[model samples]
Target chain A: MGEFELIRNFFAAAPCAQGGEGVALGIGDDCALLAIPTGEQLAISTDTLVAGVHFADPCDPFLLGQRSLAVAVSDLAAMGATPIAFTLALTLPTVTTDWLQAYARGLSLMAQSCRVALVGGDTTRGPLSMTMTVFGRVPNGLALTRSGAQPGDLLCVGGELGNGAGALPLVLGERTAEPAIADPLLAHYWSPQPQLALGQALRGKATAALDISDGLLADCGHIALASKVAVQVECDRLPLSSALVAFLGKAGAQNAALSGGDDYVLAFTLPSVELPPLLAEGWPIHVVGRIVAGQGVTLLDSDGQDITPQTRGYQHFRESP
Target chain B: MGEFELIRNFFAAAPCAQGGEGVALGIGDDCALLAIPTGEQLAISTDTLVAGVHFADPCDPFLLGQRSLAVAVSDLAAMGATPIAFTLALTLPTVTTDWLQAYARGLSLMAQSCRVALVGGDTTRGPLSMTMTVFGRVPNGLALTRSGAQPGDLLCVGGELGNGAGALPLVLGERTAEPAIADPLLAHYWSPQPQLALGQALRGKATAALDISDGLLADCGHIALASKVAVQVECDRLPLSSALVAFLGKAGAQNAALSGGDDYVLAFTLPSVELPPLLAEGWPIHVVGRIVAGQGVTLLDSDGQDITPQTRGYQHFRESP
Candidate 1:
């Protein structure tokens, strides 16, 4: 099939466009028209993942598709934006019908899971990479932002941390584990769920919120800098998944939780008194630290002693280890 | 410098962001927030241009930057969408301050000219390529689409048609011309202005509209398929810029006007009754053809004899000439 037919047959017919809200017009148009509610503002996010850079070369097309959209959608969740639609800019060296089908299936699965409509996209021949831009809606004055954190607020995360980072060795084939341990970690790497509901719930309640893509420590530094306050993380309190601790012992697991990336979990701060209500509702909110009247992020031990590591989290353009 | 610093100093500080409108939040956020007027809908379009495929490798980064964004914004114009904001997903081979500076300068210039704000983007190291997703605003239900054309409508185009295609020889370094002739052709190749105003004016007036990127004949086929009407083009009526004619001569310029690509000129159809006001208002509406009750596009010679070309316009993945 021609490039146009490939996109039309696979992407346009993907589950994301079968039936979704806010997509006034989909593919085969000069532009996709989207309806935004009168008083609501549109939340937009973009992410690009390149082969052998973001994921392993020769990775599963389905998993790659799922991971690509999931990570991009994470930013929408970070802003308390309800999933509405997305556009895919896919560059491939060549078109393989088998690969396209599998990839579209994975993308369709995630788009269905997130309830995000695939409204528009462009496909071109190039090195394998996917750039997805997601759109969502948020009511005015209620949207969460990184600059709203306040002193005396409690720091929290949506769920376990470092699983994706912990899964790195297995992902690269440097190590292997039983399916029991591998499945969860692989899912973390390939299909980490974006905390959309938690972010929506925290809106107007949490002072600040963001999805953790670049390890907890580095991402916390972002909140700190933007909010103009210090975030003290109690290393002892980091929530590590049992699967992660089983694979990488206690200290290793803690290290992963402290510095691992691509968890796609919600991290935020709210008044101390505001935590109980969210907890009582059975939202997997883990209290990991607190916001303080200072700048930057500080790591503290169980005994309240500073135990910051020698290195921070991942930074792009740095030489790979 | 760190990756964040590179983006902050280069892209975020570009002139496009210095007091642009409709962007509630620009770069440096998990997602950019945008506000739309109560009765308007968001028009979204994405285009990805790859090195050595869409443009030449080792070309002027400044020109590439300007042309890349200008072409994508052309789709917004084709939809009659007003300038709003855009997100850029830029992939580079390595971090070079010189290239980044020039590229950003060109992008900023185009963004400023179009009055579009750079709301959000991501930067990463990879093969040199750019994927730009632009957002614009359109009054609800007033946007133009390719499916609205009807029989007996006059086919019109905005401005000259073949300058870019006529300039291809210079772009590939296969031919050279005097500066007086070459400069304008190169400008058409490197920085063709999107017909934004004409497109906006044609919103409700034109039955169907689109910007011509692929040659006129192929793109016209698209309108015929979508609108289910036959289009008859009068070869003698094709608009050719003076610079194009000077470079390629009469017959060659007409051929280029009929089948050359990358013009970014608006091609649309409207009922005979709707043409007067737009033409009377001094819009650069060049009537090139008329719609009939059939399928596909037909070319007629000056003597009114059928003279359709054997080949159509450019198609991605098709073998290069």
Candidate 2:
């Protein structure tokens, strides 16, 4: 088949939202057309995930597809915006019908779950890589940013941290899976639920927000730097899943919670007055620390001891020791 | 420095448009904020160019940078939309300051030319590839589509074709270039001029519009299929640069124009009315053919003899004969 036929078979058949306010034409064209609302603004973000670097080579194509789109949509969530449309640029070594079907199924499932429409993108022959660029719409000046955290604001995170990172050993076959531990971790890593609703609700309520992809400490450092404040995270207050705690003792789980990446949880800051209602929702937010009037990040234990190095997360381009 | 720092130093330093209608936040954050205009729509398109696959591995980094962005912007052109914002996902094998500088320079120059803001994207370590997703705004119902061409509409193309294809031999060291032919052909291939202005101007005027990326016959076939019509082109009327004609001979140039890719020229159809004064303004447009009530594409020679090839442009998975 020709390029157009391949695209029609693999992508054009995927599910998409029909006739939305901004989406004039969804797919099956040279470019996807969108109609933006008068008072709202559009947020755009792009990310690339390579097979060996981002996921295991032999991983399920369906999960890879879901995770790829999920990771990109997570950026929209971090911005406190709702996903409108996304374009996928997929480079594959070869075309396989079985692979394509599974991949499309996964991508379609997530796209439907997030209420996002698949727009226009390119397919090429190359090393296995997928790049997704997601677009979102937000009311002008209401989107959350990383630069609004102030001193004394509570540092909070949505959901448990490090489930994805903790599951890596099992995914890579380096460790055996305990049913309780392995299932949740694998689910978190493979199919992250982007906290779009929570983010949109926290739009005006939260001072600063970002998804934790590069581990809690490292990602918190991002917010601190952007907001020009120090963060004092309490080691004891970190949220650890019961399964994670059971899998790896409290200390090990705490280490993973601090340094593990791919959590896809929103780490945000809010004033004390705005914290109660959010905390009342019981949305798994842990008041791990407070924003401070300083320049860098510091981790404080229950006895007020500094435990920084032991909890620092992974850095890109740095060799893992 | 870390990967984030390297990206901030190189890619993020370029100036972006401060306050566009949809751009609530530009760069330097987890995700950008955009405000979609109430009555308008957003057009999205993405493309990825890999080293050795899309362009030569040792190609000039500056040109590669320009061509990558230009090719992506061409998608916006095809939709007859106004350029607004873009996100770039860059993967590189190593951190080379010189290479980064050159590439950034080219990207910045093109962004300035297109009046597009560099919003937000990710940078990672991997094989060299660049993916850009561009956003544009179009009026509610004025965006052009490939399905609008009618049977009696005239087919026209902007600028000369095949210079890029003709330059491939020289770029690959298969042919030695004389100074006269080398400069123009190299410029055509390296720094392609996206027909954004022409495309936007043709928004309501042209029945169907698309950029010729996969050569004339192949792209026209897209229009034909989308519009449910046949296309007939006069071979002698095909726009051919003097350099290409001299370098590759008339027949060879014709072959290249018909079958080669990477020509970011606009191919559109206009109703049989005043030619829209495109030529008087020094914008080169050659009227080559007309849409007909038939199934496929046909080409006519100077003597009115059928001369179109059975095959058209490159297919991604197909082997070259």
Candidate 3:
């Protein structure tokens, strides 16, 4: 079989959906097509993760596949869009059946969880890299934006942070992999759960919303600048997993929560009133601080003393190759 | 003020058609939204061009912009779909205002030409590379397929082939630029006129269709294998431009035409009742060969003797980095 036929056999398996506005056509074409509902708008985002840049070279292909799709789909969550379909661009040194199978397995698992269908993509011979372009649907003009936060809005996060970054050392073999530290960290890094339901629930309730791909402090700063408001993050109230606190001390865990990256949790601002039961249950919702009618972000200690951040999250420009 | 704002300003200035049939929302959001027509399916394709890989590092930013979009859009054309929107992932070493402006200009020009709007895409600080994911719409179950060609069909091409590959030496400065030879070749490379119109015109009429990005012989082989048929090309009937002939001798031009890449013209097979008016207006439609009930490609010389191709097009696995 030629390249095209081989691709069709392996990657062009038909997209599956159980009713509710699914993919109209998936794979085996120049582009996949979807049919969005009348009141919905398609949400789209693209992200590229290069081997040795985004993830370690020897990392499991399955984990890479899951993380790659999760990261792109997280953008949809930030926009309060419902996941629909995605396209993957994979550049590899060569076609290895074993590697492809493992990678496809991971990708299919996450896709099945989110009801996201693999639509189409290209495969080429190059340095290992994966670029996923994800598509979602949101009600017209209801999608959350970073500029929507008001001065009195409460700063909130949907889940624990820093576990992904705190677990990185173990994943890289720099630190010994203990079950207490490795399992959660590996889970956080390998298979991040995009908070699509939480985002959709926050459609009109949250004043501003964004995903914490970078550190909490840096991503919150995005809200501050975009909304032209001041943000006070109470460091003591920062959410941390029990595993994280035990592995890295309380202070170290706090540092990771504040400055670590790769936690695809929803960071949003809402009114101080009680949130919907749907959003408050199962998901960990922490009230870190509140927005003020000013600009820039400020961190506060339990005693109301100003605290300076020693490091910010990953900066594409400043990070060393 | 921040990365998000920077992206907003950079892309918002480009012209975009607002509130079309498929586009639910344009730019300035985490993801652009599209509402696919109810009965139609979407076609998608992605292509990546790296600096010093797809084009010269010092190549014109405008031409790079044009060619990058053109190459991706050509895939949609090959599928007999209508262009809708695209996302661009640009990784740059540094932000150069002049370079960005020129690149945006070229990108906007092509986007406008095809009426496809620029949607959401990511930007990163890394080696210069561009990945474009293009979207198009086609009627349900009506899109052309590479695997649809059958025996007894006529193999045809939309326009002149190999000018882009022939111009490579000049573009790399390995040879001096001569207008008689340089202009057409460069134009063909820089601003490829994707056969969208021709492709749309061939929807139900043609058996199989694809763009000639790799080269006539190589891409035709793709169709043959996909459709499980044999393809034969008439050497003397191959399309040639006067400029190509003037620059390179007959044999030299033939070799380039047969083996060169990056010519995003359409090659399709149709019944041989009446040819399209592409040739009468000098747009370069050549009936090079025919398909038979077998496998692989065969070439015939001027005297109808079987001729072997001296060169084959670029192969991703075989090319040296």
Can you tell me which runs of candidate 2 are displaced by over 4 Å?
A: A17-21, A310-312, B16-22
* Models sorted by lDDT, best on top: 1, 2, 3
Best by DockQ: 1
Better of 2 and 3 by DockQ: 2
> What's the i-RMS of each model?
0.8, 1.5, 2.8
Per residue, candidate 3 scores C-alpha lDDT tens digits across B1-321 of 334544566766666434445776666556777766766777778887767767888779988888899999999899899999899887776777788788888988888888788877877755678789998888877787888888888999887877988888888988865687799898888999888888888888788988988778888878888789999888788888888777777877777777787888888888776365545545456788898998988888988898867555676545355
Error of 3 at B107 (Å): 2.4
Of 2 and 3, the candidate ahead on TM-score is 2
Task: Identify the leading candidate in terms of lDDT.
Answer: 1
Best by TM-score: 1
- Per-residue lDDT tens digits for candidate 1, residues B122-229, read 998889999999999999999999998999899999989899999989998999999988999999999989889998999889999999998899889889999999
RMSD of each: 1.2, 1.8, 3.6
lDDT string, candidate 3, A238-290, tens digits: 98999898888999999889888889999999987746564556556788999
lDDT score for residue B132 of model 1: 96
lDDT of 2 at B131: 88
After superposing candidate 3, which stretches have Cα over 4 Å from the reference? A1-21, A93-101, A272-276, A279-283, A303-312, A319-321, B1-23, B94-98, B150-152, B273-284, B302-305, B308-312, B319-321
In model 3, what is the error at residue B61, expressed in angstroms? 2.7
Better of 1 and 2 by DockQ: 1
